[model samples]
Target: MPQDDKISPRKPRRAWPVAMAVVAVVAVVAGAVTWRGQADDGAPSPDHPRNRGTELVIAVGDVAGGEFDPLKGWGSRPAQIRLIHSSLLTVDKNIDFVGDLASDYSVSDDALTWSFTLRDNARWSNGEPVTAQDVIFTYDTLKKDGTRFDLTFLDRMEARDDSRVDFHLKEPRSTFVSQLSDIPILPAKHYGTDYSANPIGSGPYVVADYQVGQQLILEANPHWYGQRPQFTKLTFLVLGEDAALAAARAGTVDIAYAPPAFAGQRIDGMTLQSFETVDSRALTLPTLPAGGKGKIRTNDVSVGNDVTADPAIRKALNIGLDRDQIAQIVLQGHGRPAYSLVDGLPWFNDQVVFEDGRTEDAKRVLADAGWSDSDGDGTVEKDGRKAEFTLLYPSDDQLRSDLALAVAEQARALGITITTKGSTWDGIYLDGKANAVTWGGGRHHPHQIYEMYSSKVIDSGYNNMPQYTNTTVDGYLDQALSATTQDKANEFWKQAQWDGQTGFAGENGDTPIIWLLRLDHLYFVRDGLNLGDQPIQGHGHEWALFNTLVQWHWTS
Candidate 1:
């Protein structure tokens, strides 16, 4: 969900430190961020476009501690971790692997070994040259610590002198390449237990100070090897949604994470920036019977929901509800009506999409499946079993709760009784196993498909919450992971969802989850700041905000 919370490293992203002089940029900045600007105080207002302020202060929501650490799953999402540190490889918005710290890379004929050539000019913020040893150490630590990226296939890593590194794999796991973009490299000599608090890396900026519950201040790294940033100093103020909006209205900050609820608000020096994201909200229903025996990542966890386990009910729910209308109503028209987890992505099977709002169609499917409202009551039943279930959402999350409530409203029309409840995640896992729980799943990589639909990760952390299992889907996932080329893998990933015959999507076969809508990340940036072409943001809003942070500059 936005690694805004450490709920899953799910979107733990990157941020870089800056040390620009922002006094002329805005009227007021919080403590310790005083700046001596390049222009005089009496100069024409810097509020207009083309006024290149030396400093930038932003009011953001998710700058929690430990998120700055890459080894601990920080860079897994599209966050600021990439700003302070560089990975050997980086992923572009096109979902293609490009070089970051490493400039050139290739794989062996056997596909068991991958190698990279590091950039000669890259150096740490601490004035030390970044080396292959650092890359090796970073990956080694991630493997040992069990990070978000899968590295079990790693046999070992070797460095060829200072500028090159080679990764030896236990198998021809093609997914290993995707892992390179998910991690941020760390310097070997200085990395320690307290590294997250005091990090040293080779990104465009360096962490100057982070006052808990207050703000994070960053300064430009003199030793940075990339293009020089326009703003030298970066300040991140941690404020609640309303509080950040207030600060934005006051013109005290350059940018703020604008809540969709208040998306229509207008501010004098600020303009709204909407980013389409893979971050989505959906309902994962249990596919087995009540009290059924199943394992969740090697550990036994009860999994079942008799009512939801029915394919008819799932298929009905998939096509019955008008998700497009819901996206408009619930998301303030900022989100896309999501069908499959990866809708517009390359690997997604567009066949999963159906003309929603067909409540009569949903009823017809249910009636054919022997589910009918024979009773005087509005709810349907089959064999004396009522078609009823509870949908749970994290009590604190308003958006998910809204989605749950909205989805419940539509499902009820189909004669499927849906009762919505807001509860803690702990309580959901503890009791909602057999019940439908609203889930968050979206990312740039096709592996997100593997994680959600693949049998290999059914019970693994946060993936396959419905405990969905299909031999055909499993085989497709395995083939995707093993394919030597990305094109072949993409094909298999699509086939797993809907192979034109039988697959996971309800239209074709089974539907373990009622795919809902993807959230749109909205922000209020000061006028004149051009952020350039932004990538479609993924699960982490905070991490993905600055996908092209360096390219952001003032416009005339």
Candidate 2:
């Protein structure tokens, strides 16, 4: 939903390798390791020790291929890439961007040019000094080869000296620095077409051994400039959910990701850790017809249901639902009620709150818009057209299915008829055929709002799924991107939500999307393992659990 997992090349999402389908199910090993001195009731102990381990075993859903090519081998293997390579910038536990290979960076007055100075002592795993040339080579290679990331905004890249590199941009972009946090710098001299197989990097850890479809072993990098990892070895075992849970129960794995369904289940010596996420589940509303206003588009399409095209109908749907009940019943209390696309994030605007279950207000808005229950009929109708639309949800997602049913029931109480139906991702979202569908998304940066709601992204093939178009929304998003400082940019983002005239919550405006709740990520950790502070997660990947690997330790 963050556009990072979509397979389309034109879209902002990352493309997974075709081999992922073959490795979805892996065999579980027999005879898991058993440990003694288990905690009572498996609850975390208050007197647990710290920094007492030389090795750790973590169970993951999948294994990364031996390939370590930063340009070609990412998305599908984020954990491996992050451990083996170092980016110019990195985000801390607070989600704040900081330098990794770079010592400092500066932006020009017009925001069109940025310059970064490399840390003098930064060296690759092979003990070669990381220079500005490596940074330039990485950027130039990505631009020339057309990597998954969109770097078209860059005009040119130049290295002023061995320690400095400058980037000139075609347009001002406030989030450019944040985006650079994921692009790892590679050693240009050692890089080849097959470099992914034996990659060298400047990160704190290096790949020691790799066994395809089984496990990967990581060792501390002797030449790392930062604080060295305490653990001498880290082994990541490939396992499915059931297998991971089995391993955790038997004390074979030090850490494993757990879903909400495993909430009450307790292991003999493990602690369940829950962390907040920015990811949210919402419903998308169509604002325009499928076909162009006058001409035909690439593919033949039909105009969406006219009932949802009305702004009053969308507004009523937004304020008419009891989100708290949905969070309790649908999510089993694992999530919190969400009011906007970015409810828990720092940039989220608190002023645009929606009242719960305002059935009377919803009825008045629909009635004012020419809808009436004529002839004492329960359903509202105007000019022989009934207020009815079909709500679609993916057939396989239990959470979405439950939410759809709840929404339909609430809409019926307000004189609106909503028919719930099951649909596949391709059937409902590929061409935007369904009237309304449950949507998912969340991003670490506030630019996500511009990508999903701006009129400019309607034709971008990723977000703007409902074809929402507004000149005022586009202007505000542009201003947010061009702002000189982050504080000023945050104000512009808030304005895009509600500016008292033409925002998503303005008097005359109807929101194109309805938010429900933010899901929390759960994990099972062994009693002695101490994972450092973790930041709220975004939607794309699950590898963020090991972001603080350097700080992880075990107690006796």
Best by TM-score: 1
Model 2, residue pairs in steric clash: 3-13, 4-14, 68-196, 69-196
- Per-model TM-score, in order, reads 0.86, 0.78
In Å, residue 26's CA in model 1 sits off its true spot by: 19
lDDT of 2 by residue, 218-254 (tens): 7889999987778878877766566677667655567
**Residue-level lDDT tens digits of model 1 in 1-556:** 0123222122223332222213212323322122332333433222432234888878767565455776555775654567788877776777677898888999988788899999999998889999999989988888887636677889999998899889998877767766777678888999887776678888888887665554667789999888887889988876657667766765667888875677899888789999888888788888888887665434566788889989899989988989888887778889878888888888888888878889999999999999988876989999999999999898756577788888988888999999998887767765556789988877777777777777677656567778888999899989888887778888998888889888887464688877888889888998899887887777756667776888889898
Q: Cα lDDT for residue 338, model 2? A: 86
lDDT of each: 0.77, 0.71
